[model samples]
Target chain A: MKLLQLAVAVLLVAVLGGSPLSAGARTWQIDPAHTNFYFTVDHIYSKVRGHFNTYSGAINFDPQRLGESSFSFKIATDSIDTNLAKRDKHLQSADFFDAGSFPEMTFASTKVVDAGQGRYDVHGTFTVKGVAYDLVLPLTFAGVKEHPAMKGKEVAGFNGTLVLDRLAYKIGDGKLYKLGVVGKDVEVLVTIEALADK
Target chain B: MKRTLLQIFFLGIGALVVAGGCALPFLYPTQTLWYKTGWEKAVLQTGHLFGVFAFLALVLQLLFGSRGALLERAFGVSLVMRLHRANGQILPLLVLCHMALVLLPEGLANLPLGLTFWPEMVGGAALLAIVVQVVAAQVRQRFSLDYRRWRSGHRWLGYTVLLLAAVHVLFVADSFASGLPRLALLLLVGMMALRLVYRMVSSRR
Candidate 1:
């Protein structure tokens, strides 16, 4: 029992970390060419897949920093593609996304928790079309490596997926709110490739 | 009785077919016959099929049941009522299927499947309105309220579907987009307007 207790204490201490990471310790710039934001919808009997074609964002990485690391991004709502032109327009109209009134969908991270093994669960507020909601993203790190495209530059990756219930933010709200015609629970798949500045 | 039954039988089979998946080409005004395009025609055909069933069920509900009798009749009343209920439930699914065929593809087709075409959003607000009413009806039913109140909701959704479809045929369609289909589409709207006027005048009396 004494041996087990000591082992548990050591594990807890190691897991807890020596100290919380300070703010602005390490800032990472996003590479637009590498990042992607994809979403899915239920199209009646079938499922429709789409994504935002244009977006830009930056991330501040501080592993132990809960409130220190900041992330922000803006995606052009009009650049959304389900591959269909007319439906995309309808999605932007009043009955659906109302992208005309509220164009850019944005997200800014508030806090991130290190879950060991270079994994993190980021809590961020995401504004889609116009509605805002708190989002939790469970992320897996792809590790830092020498970027093949850029000489002497290192890039870090984090891939995460989250189910977004459109009704929460009222993206396509109201009764027809039915996954009936539209879809319920849009999948938000994000791939962030950030570069270390120094 | 048999003629009505025959019409209903055909309508039922067609509705189930289009509603369930096999979208057969059937056009209104009875003139164009089965002229169809790749998929839009499939959707129109399905919606038309559902409309046929809706019309049949409306007629059955109109002529068959004793709305006020309460508990008088048996056997046949229960049977017809059952059919009416079945038809009622299936009706919206068919409409939804039809709506998806036309609407979903406009956005989804761009993917690798090419199942949807990014076409035109010709319906001003009709489709949107229908979505609202349908949801309200479901809520009302779930809440165990009077189905009669749903009539108003039902009527509005129907009107929206018909109106928007007319506009859809006019501004958006490619082949039947203009000329005679336009005229016939207008005629359907006119008929709907007249029905509304008649109902309003009679209700006021």
Candidate 2:
């Protein structure tokens, strides 16, 4: 019985220390070049897609310190593009971005919550068109890797998706005029390739 | 009596312009997709609402013209009249968007003045002349000046706009088909021929 107890204790120590869940903090810098901010809106009864050409942000993560992780990101309102010149101008007008009044769009992370396996729930305050709203984005812990250029740095990457009812956020007037020219529901997909900060 | 033809011409041509604006389709896979086709930039800012108001304007203008003419052709002439004027004034403004994208500085640099601005100026002049003629015919009927001069100038200016605009779109639109320009060129020639024949027949009578 003594021998069995000793073995059990040893196993427990090994599991606690060496497990992937072990606590170690990491901070990541978003690779702005590789990052993409993509969104889609309703187009003439069908779906049309678009994205911002300019956006920058960072994410910090540590599996052990799930509650401590945070992120901050911002996209330039002027960077919006819809691939059609006529439609793009209209989107930027007071009818949409009203970019002149609200020059920048931003996102600042508040806290992280423990979600299921290797997953997390990140809460952030997002400001768009000068309106601030809190959002809970479901995130997948993609794992950490040593920074290619920095010897002591490690980066944590993640893929996250959030559904935004632009209506709730007051993106555009939800009232459909002349048979729904704009769509209310918007899904934002973010793929972050963040570089670790030493 | 002559104003009837003018209204019909404006309505017909206005519908063509409006329909053309609506039918414009887009193709992509470009890096500067926004700059190249930046409709959202305009729509979000001012063009969207402008589009609504302009369409409203077209209907209004159409209704005003229809007051003394036939009302049996359309339903709710009041509403449609609002749309007619809204569309008429707004279509050209909306064209500014496509112009901003497709007619980038480089595109503008290459087009001849005739294809670029002169033809439009001629068209503008012709339109102004038509307005003057309409006023003169209504207000100065005692002068009894012949109408053919103004009509001739207006017709020539319209032809100039048609020709130059065709050349302009062919050179710049990038979407021009293999034979469409040639077909349009032929149609222009055929229309000119038919109109001259009609003029000759009318003069003989």
Candidate 3:
């Protein structure tokens, strides 16, 4: 009877561990209307700015256990808008995003480390045009609040910036690589406002 | 007195072209004002101004190329020819400045393969034509080529360069999108066409 009771206790522990309710953090879906992903690059003389219009992401977080939080995001590559119709078309071509073959860019965080003062270093794998690279995004949590429009719903806000090398990702090749008409480093700024699931 | 008037006329046109190119940023607010450095803006602006001046020099060369009486009345044949020769040497340098100002900022590693677009192809052809004209002039005596043959080749190449230049200017619509500058370009092109046609008809006679 003692051995049977011990086995039952072990089985109960395993069941509880595998349950989603036991997870430390809540899942929050990024609100598209409130989230913006902007990128800027030097265009020989001045900085050219553009933003991605379509993207979605989910953040799993618990402020008390920051290390256990993770984020996964996917961006539709073709939704890039830069004000100029012709230039936007060129950016979508193989010379830049190559949106046909690689319609989406993605990031999935493997680890999140607290860096004091509400800052975090999110280590993730960023995949672009089928090329995946390890990148660390320095993020800051602004605050969490009750949704103003939806009662009983919680919302969280975070912002971060990431710098990427175009050549490192093979975004530009051949003439573009040698011309360097566009700057090598591209700066990406992300502002995320996510809504917690009820 | 007529020669002085002709000089003033040409200088005025040259000033107009350069001023138009310079004023492009103001007429169209499309260009971004936020630059990392003032040098970048200066390079791009100077490059465009130099491009217009270079093209104007080319047009002057074409206009004064022949020793026709009508042109001689406005500016003596000898004076016209002298100005043409002077521009021939100076035009290449202006082109070099324009290219350097625009391209150097991009760095050396970004040399794409070869001419990929229509404007680029025409611009490349114009540059090549100028180089060939200079090289052929230098080597004609060495190669023992007939003077008439060399002159004919030179004239044909100059015309080709002029034609290619027109296409290059028109295709580059960033600064000349729509305004007085664009109107001026079209007027200049129309005047060039009339002059060329008149020259051809008179030469045939």
Best by lDDT: 3
Tens-digit per-residue lDDT, A77-175, candidate 2: 766777854455446555567665786889888988878887788888988877788888777878777877768877667778777787776665654
What residue pairs are clashing in model 3? A175-B112, A178-B109, A178-B110, A178-B111, A179-B110, A179-B111
Which ranges in model 3 have alpha carbons more than 4 Å from their true place?
A1-198, B1-36, B111-118, B141-144
Query: What lDDT score is found at residue B92 in candidate 2?
Result: 53
Candidate 1: where are CA atoms >4 Å away? A1-23, A64-67, A177-179, B1-205
* Complex DockQ per candidate: 0.04, 0.01, 0.05
The local distance difference test score of model 2 is 0.56
lDDT of 2 by residue, B24-134 (tens): 332211122333223443332233233323332323332343332343243345745565444444445544443443334223332223423443344334334334433
Report the C-alpha displacement of residue A46, candidate 1, in angstroms. Answer: 1.8
All candidates: TM-score: 0.46, 0.49, 0.53
lDDT of 1 by residue, A83-158 (tens): 8565566566554566657778888888888878877888889887666778877888787888888887888898
B79, model 1: CA deviation in Å?
Answer: 58
A170-197, model 3: which lDDT tens digit per residue?
8876344345457878899989999984
Interface RMSD of each: 10.3, 12.6, 10.2
